[model samples]
Target chain A: MLRALRVASPLAVVALWQLASSLGVLDPSTLASPAQLARTAWELTRSGELPHAVAVSARRAALGFALGAAVAIAAGTVVGLSRVGDAVLDPLMQMLRMLPLFGLVPLFIIWFGIQEEPKIYLVALAVVVPLYLNLVAALRGVDRDLVEVARVLRLRRAEAVRHVYLPAVLPGVLVGLRQALGLAWITLIVAEQVNAGAGLGFLVNNARDFLLTDVIVVGLLCYAALGLVTDGVVRALEWRALRWRDGGETA
Target chain B: MTGTDLTTPVVAAAHGVRRAFGDHVVLDGVDLEIRRGEFVTLLGRSGSGKSTLLRIVGGLDQGAEGDVRTGTAPAVVFQDPRLLPWRRVLDNVALGLRGPDARARSTEVLDEVGLAGRERAWPRQLSGGQRQRVALARALVREPDLLLLDEPFSALDALTRISAQQLVRRLVDVHRPAVLMVTHDVEEALLLVDRVVLVDDGRIALDEEVGVRRPRRRDDPDLVRWRTRLLGLLGVADA
Candidate 1:
């Protein structure tokens, strides 16, 4: 019953929207009707424009997220593992973290040029802060008693990391990854808007220029779908990784 | 399992061990010894330093000033189960063991603890008593020369505590590791320990050998007498 309601809620809203469009209660210029949006999506699909744009946006998000997560994990591990590492790098990272990464799009464009580099750089920068912060916090939050267990068990350094620290940090890192994914999508949209592009943002911009509200809506629905899909994948990974956790619920 | 020789050698010996925290001393010039295959209990009040002494013997708190010699690194079962929440029951038991057959060895030990088919379960999936059983299994799987239990059953309910106590006694009889368990319960110390030592004001006040034979009952007159004596030492008036 609850699952049925969840499906019904979205359908109900769409139905109301379609009704409003039919009665002319809503303007066709600003908001596309469900039928119009569907026709537009089908047209773009047949013409191959939507797929091409989707490919471009998906690649950028994937590459940018991987780059950001890699750097953050490395830096977070270093700063978390040793007192000296924490003392050296954490302060500067904290200062950098306070800056709004979205505002750096213009700066990145100037530095790396108005191309793929700037767009990818924006997504990478957007995700790094939360990833690093969560990693550091999780590392520091490892149970002291568990560490003592490792000591008593005579687990060597590598074994301790593999069994103790890695497991301890994983749940927190996965949460951070999900948050970073959200930020990555927002940053990608904004970054794609700043310059001439061959991505979803470019498609939306072209549609807006031609007053193609249906096509613009299709572009946004694609973004929402991609976000949902990626989030679902991460949730599945978390479910498998945290099988030891109670409830056994997927994200 | 290796055959345990009762007269083989001393399992653990602590000589002039002293641990202090600034002005407050925990274990002050304490000396203790355990024979192979013996079950010893340290009974004391809340601040009696029984845990400090256990830590020193376990080689965990090296800040103590003294020497401790043991046949090998002692395995410890803490008050809490202390099993890694992320690992499955079998993995937690196999933590310290090595080699190709560690998984099979862990399975055997888990079964010995009477958790025959719960090897794949997580720590949280088990009850309080079951988790403690896993802790005992983890300690035993390593087959250490000495097993130090710091109030391992203190957190359990009355009925669960009795069953857990029985399990520990049975395991000790079979595996024959020199056991030094610290607890504040007089009845527990009398029921499980071959020898009971009282710690008071950073010293061993009474080290009495309980003359009761194996598998003694709680209502036995000898156990009753020892409980009265220990309670008196702890400043609790006899009922």
Candidate 2:
């Protein structure tokens, strides 16, 4: 019953929205109706424009996320594991994260040009903050008792990290992964806007010139879809990695 | 396990050991020794430095004020079990344990602890008693000369505690490692250990030999008398 209500609530809203559009209570130019948006989306998909934009956006997001996550994990581990590293690096990391990163898009374009470099860098910077913070917090929260166990086991530093630290950090890392993926999409949207070139942002920008509200709506929906898809992927990963997390012990 | 006689070689020894966390000293000038194939329990209240002493002896803590040495890096079973939740029962048991036979030995120890077929289970999937058993197996799989236990049974319920105790006692008999267990339970001390070292005011207040025969009863008069003495020493009314 609850699941049905959950599904029905969103459906009811869409139904109401479409009704408003059909009755001409809403203007398509002002705000495209759901049906018009769907038509535009289908037309764009058939012309291969939507697929090309999605591919371009995905490549940027994936590359930036990959680069950002690698650096964050490495730095988070260093700062998490060593006091000197924490003292030296954590404040620096926090400072970098605290900056209004999006505001730097102008400077980034000037420095790296309004090329792929600036956009990818913007997305990477956006992805870095969330993953790094979550990872550090998770590492700090590791069971010290298990570290003692690692010591007693006579595991080498690397072995201890592999068996103890890595697994312990996984849940937090997955949480970060979800956040970073979401941010990567948001960052890419703003990034591709500056370039006014190939990507979902370009499609939306191009539609605005011709007042193609339905096509712009389609682009917006694509961005939201990208966010949901990445989140779903991370959620699936979390489900697998944390299957051993406490639910209830066998009696 | 029935502990061996005093003639056996000492597996671990500590002298004038001291530990302080910032301003507070936990273990002060504490000296203790455990013979091979012996079972010793450090009897102390919370904050009495029994665990601090154990950590020092187990090589988990460093920068102590005095000498502490063990024949080999000791195996420890903490109250929390400390099994990696990500590792299955068998992997946890085999962790950091080297040799081509490590996996087989881990299986044997799991069976010895009565967890024969549950090797594939995750640590979080086990009950508290079962998890503690896995921790014990993890320690025993190493075949260390010294086993350090930090209140290993304090987490279990009454009935499960008894079973876990029996399992430990049986494993000690089979493996014959020198065991140093820290606990506040006087009855537990009397039931399992060959000697009880009372820790008080950050020192060894008393190191009395139990000298009781194997399979001691909880209500045994000798044990009762010692419990009363210990309770009094711990400043209990013993009413």
lDDT of 1 by residue, B25-86 (tens): 89887888887788888888888898888888778887898878764958999999999998
Q: Which parts of model 2 have CA positions greater than 4 angstroms off? A: A1-27, A31-36, A246-251, B1-7, B16-30, B202-205
State every prediction's TM-score relative to the real structure. Answer: 0.93, 0.90
For residues B85-149, could you state the per-residue lDDT of candidate 2 as single tens digits? Answer: 88888999999988999999999989989999999888877889999999899888888899988
What's the residue-level lDDT of B129 in candidate 2? 93
DockQ of candidate 1 is 0.46
Interface RMSD of the candidates, in order? 4.2, 2.8
What is the Cα root-mean-square deviation between model 2 and the actual structure? 2.8
Highest-lDDT candidate: 1
Chain A only TM-scores, each candidate in turn? 0.94, 0.94
lDDT (Cα atoms) of all candidates against the true structure: 0.88, 0.87
